[model samples]
Target chain A: MKKNLMAVLVGVLLTLLSLSLIEVYYRAFVPPKAEVFAFVPSTPVEVPEARLSAELISQIQGDPIMKWRSLGSAYEGEYNAKVVDVSKQGPLGCCVLQGFFAPPGKVHSRAYTKHRDLLYDVHFTFDQRSRRITPEVSHARNALLAFGDSYTLGEGVNDEESFPYVLGTYRASTQVYNLGLMGGSANQTLYEVTKLPEKRLPDLPDQEVTAIYTFMVDHLERLICRSLCLTAQGMWRLNQPFYSLKNGRPYFEGAFSDRKVLNSFYTWFHQSAIVQGTGMVLPPQFTQEHFDFFATMMVEIRDVLKTKYPKLKFYVVMYPGSSDPYGSDLTAACKKRGLNVLNYASVDITGLAQKRERIAGEGHPSPIAHMILARLLNRDLPQ
Target chain B: MLLQEFWDFMRERKKYWMMPIIISLLALGFLILFSQTAVLPFVYTLF
Candidate 1:
């Protein structure tokens, strides 16, 4: 027994020695990089690249649940476009109440960098009544409602370059609402279409419209609040609405205000790769239910949207390509629930990496790609 | 000189416990050096 204990102790010592060496190697060779921590942003910091002013960036630092009161925290006006100030805003609610993330009549203008490190401007405008990003057209014979995360929101592109806006250009009579929330998941997109106020959802079927939910694999992490995608200076975001699966049915669990523990853990866990690869991650509250919940929410959104536009055709468009393990499952789920699904993996977004059509610093769909999707949608959307 | 003497003493006494201690100290020294470079971010990917 004595010999055995010594042997075991020696073995442990060896393992410790190995770890120590590895840690040393990491320390000796690795260069420090600007890393994002998984904590909810507190303390305003200057993001020189962002369009907002430095003073505004410093003001919105704090626990997100308490800080985010309204949609536009900072406000500025330019004849070029209506800009909503978000320097004071932080992570938003945990669950969707109005079936949307922002208030009505809001426009978000941001500056981003593309592949060559060249700068570009992007804008998102929400309609006055529906609160969705309607096309710039004044009068349209019909409308298209689109939703997803940043890519759908035209992350590195202008408002006119978003897929919804380009789709409106394809058919002058159709007004498209870009309901793509900045950091949304597929389930969150579904919630935005289904959870809005009664008056917000138009039940009358006077207009011919199409509702498309655009998604990418990256949204999976956002779906479960497993990661934080940097939005702006001092604007680390992940605190959107979350859902709970009870008795196999998905229900809203509330916003960041309601999920302090989960939010806090994610806020911390996302800080470093050391934290992530070391199993310092939080256990997800539910098994991968985004597919199920997404399907359910899409069905509900379709039903409610159908009440407004009789000619509405519901579609789930996977944008910037779909490479997630859940992509197929999401497609299957959407199809099983009677929603049309389109996989846009064929677009040669080589420009994204080459910085041709996409911005050099950010790898989101460029205006060229948005136009490509618009043309594709025009060809494929059910007439 | 003390570290060399300590190493000699550990070898003689078979003080395996000191291995972890020494390695950890060396590791800390490495971290101090490596943090100044760009390769540090990739270290965490090793799991």
Candidate 2:
């Protein structure tokens, strides 16, 4: 009986080992189909090379996102033209390109790039020397501060195609500073805003920044939680107490280690899953905290901006997601704070829904969503 | 006498049960890593 049992155990172990080997083999040897939702090139189409010129090269470099390409090779293609070294935007360095294919006469389909098989569509357009905000967007106004993650930063989309750029196009007079960094959480947004110089306020015309719009959605919860863990670990790494809260809540106060961990984890997770899929899941109850942090951050931003330009308008543009419930949470939060919240969920973004397959998989909004959002903001802005 | 023999038999066989658990955990870890880094990237390229 003892001998029989030993034989069975050995057999089971061999079987498991065999299975692991098979899995690795399959993954390494077999090239699976390209993920439909991620950015994989379709059939290579052709376009005229002459369409790209020194003038166009100069124009592309002017946008903050596209400017990094100035240091590397820019090649034209028959279908999708490629621009290398767009910048170190994410996990792997990003590449920018423009594809000339569009739905029958809709002009060129704006070209963009993706890293780790993620697709970002670039649709923003700029004139020669990309530095000058298009004449249409150079209006005099209180500063426009846009804050959010990849979506707000226009990941998978072109610099011109990002909603912020689109929105800027509508309001030609205002200086729209694109502070939307990818993988940013609400806390990071607050941290960044806190660091801005106070002396820059007096230069504005209205003596008040018109609006500070911070884009937010459910993903903020997971990012915040990861940020907290990273903060704790960093303190431990530095031989310091991570931190203890007054109310017995785990909060990181002031320690540089705490901040470093938060920043690192924020970057790590942002690249891992938060930016890859529909974002990390949060329990239903924690949804309120998500909205609250966003609100609190907005208030803090308002106070800081007000100190410099005492009469600035603060707006929170609730970002849309596949699972977002039509901005109900944002409306409630804004109502409580007496703030103006843009109801982008009400806008007709049906075109984006139709092209959803070309965009991010199952539920991510596509470039059409950005366009629809831009149109909504354009309509809402004081004409 | 038969009951006494059975108890001794059970005691001898006890170590074998742990073998399956260890094998299963190793399998699970390998599977997770393979799925995340290898399988997913290959699949991403196809679509």
Candidate 3:
């Protein structure tokens, strides 16, 4: 017994001594060499062929070449979205607070892409309260609400070149509302659906509304990811909302909601690179439970919208990555709900970039791709 | 000498089973402290 006790203490001592050596070495070397990181030049992020085409399209359409905008009555003003001040906000504060904000003003500029003769003037506008991109023409009924992330919001393009604008202009009377939020998720979109018009959602039973949801791969991960927000500037934070499944139903959970103590611990844990790299203390993969929660949420969203618009035409446009397994899961879930889905998995828009890979050749369906979708959607609309 | 005596004390007192866990925790703490500054970015590449 005495010998055994001695062995354990010695073992602990040896372990501590070894760890001390490592700590000393790291303390001496790692901090000084922090900036000189080894680069592998490979990105784990893989956009599906269709998604890449979409990105290329988005990029090309944003090209400041040969496009012009007539600043009209629809122009409200230029709104700076970067003023959300990340330095002052907490996790939950960051989540809902950045939802929608429209300041007055219009930005009309004649800009051109790098070394391209594509000169275009873009006039950007937004509703003061809802931040909804006010259309050049607003219609009361037959409202088409385009909801999604940056793709629907036209992240890199002008307001005139956005998909919602193109689709709305497909017919003189089509009233399309651009409700795309940058860095937004299905969770955010669901929140938008819950609070339409002037907060608390529109409850007109007689109003015919068509809500189109654009599906992206990261939307699911973002839905349940608490504190997993990776900003455009590439900063990771222990903030953002998450949705968890309970009793076969998935509900949105605000950041650090119901887990103040756990949040405290994980927030500290995230600051450690070794722990994060181990992947043990981080978010688990998309499990069976997550898939179920995802499917459940879609039903719940539709159920919520159904309360107001019983005659709601809710459609989902699935633009999934080629190798993404979640696309199939989404299709299966949408099918189970008997929802109408337009799949662009087979549409290879990358090849379309081969000709003017410089012009309208690449990224999130270019303006031309938006035009194509507009025409396709027009064919589906009852003429 | 200290390590040897400590081992002898542990043997006498019969506390040999808790060795692995203690060492692992110690290693993790040190590793985390050291690796924090460098690997902050590129977290998206992992998850």
Candidate 4:
């Protein structure tokens, strides 16, 4: 018994020693490259808590139930162009409701390179529901639900510049809800659409409703919280929904924060030498299974909407040439499952390569692009 | 160090049957340490 105990203790110590050595080697020899810290400016720190206005705190505290729902605490009601980034950009423009994340919501920002050269300056606005503000059209007969990431939200553009706004005004009888969120993936769309009917879904008297989900290739990376996505989104994204597919159905496994052990391990792995030294990704490479799972999730979104609105028209629009590697595969999968897919890969919108089509420095579609998309959508949307 | 002590202990005790278990554990440690892709998902299933 004594010999066995000694052997077990030796074994345990050796295992621990091996792990420690590996950790030390990574920490000491494989330091992250300097370029790895490249020039991505984080959101500026909010005013100190001691100096925070009571109203701002109460409003920006975020939703208790949704947990990951609200924007940061620094955002205030009414625009102050100098408020966004006092040093370079002017404050935000007027009117930010109690929604959306800080920095990204209802602010005018000036982008600059490492040497502080001006890039692009623009404003954003959100409604009380945190949804991006799509200007209301008088006597709207139908409803338009626009979903996706920053592109759908009109990240680099103003209130009247989003495709949803143009789409809304085009029909003049459509109530548009811009449900796009920056950094959103299908997970956000699934979550929002799933909970929308349960919450205060907008009442529309129209006989038909059209929902457009703009698919960019990177959106898939965001769904799985790929290393690049996690790195880009930073700390603010921890509590956001993380989903996995189970038995051909997308399952909400809760936010990353909810899984403590995995979160800690993942956090460590992200910062570890194995990734930094080898420049290797931590998440498994996305595969056909993931695309199939995404298609099922889209189908689930369609089912939820169809159950709620009998005359729902759901469309997944893949931007021309943007959804590479798996775009056609996903489109085929969605069509096989009876979802309408519009692939813009072969459709050319003029001035796409020009600075006019993209936000300088930021790369989000400019208002021109949104208008073009709106026009194309208007032409294609079933009457 | 500890590995030497472990090997010495195992040999001294003639508990060579434990060798495979020790090797397996060291191999797992390396996998966790160097694995660029997700290993946590598999590890999570164990819990």
DockQ of each: 0.04, 0.07, 0.11, 0.07
- How accurate locally is residue A233 in candidate 2, as Cα lDDT from 0 to 100? 19
| Model 3 lDDT tens row, A358-383 | 11211233444444455445545442
Whole-structure CA lDDT of model 3: 0.50
* Candidate 2 vs 3: which has more TM-score: 3
Interface RMSD of 2: 12.0
lDDT string for model 1 (A1-383, tens) is 57545754785678666655665664566443343211111221111114333442232222131221221211111112112355434112222333334555544544422222233444445555444454565666667777666667665465566777767766777666666665566556556655653533433357777788876655554455443322111122334566666765557776533566755655664444332232222333223366766677667667766765767788877653332334566767777878888755433333222223343333445555566567667767854
Ranked by TM-score from best down, the candidates are: 4, 3, 1, 2
Please give, for residues A1-383, the per-residue lDDT of candidate 2 as tens digits: 77768866775877667656755665556443221222211221111123334453333333343332221211111122223232223121111111011111111122233332223323433222221122243446545666555456554455565677767776766666555543344544444445434311224645435654645443343234333223221111221222223342333353334466456755564333312232221121345655665555566667766776666777766553321342566556655777777644433233223333124321223445555556555555553
Scored by TM-score, the top model is: 4
User: Which portions of model 3 show Cα errors greater than 4 Å?
Assistant: A1-95, A104-123, A128-141, A195-197, A200-205, A226-242, A256-259, A275-281, A320-325, A354-383, B1-47
What are the runs in model 2 whose C-alpha is more than 4 Å off? A1-143, A198-208, A226-287, A321-323, A346-353, A357-365, B1-47
Decide which is better by lDDT, 2 or 4.
4
Winner on lDDT (1 vs 2) = 1
Better of 2 and 3 by lDDT: 3
TM-score of the A-chain for all models: 0.64, 0.52, 0.65, 0.69
Residue A194 in model 3: lDDT: 59
Sliding window of 10 residues with minimal summed lDDT for model 3 chain A: A35-44
Per-prediction backbone clash count: 31, 31, 46, 14
lDDT of candidate 2 over B1-47, digit per residue (tens): 76456446545765444455555655545533332110011111111
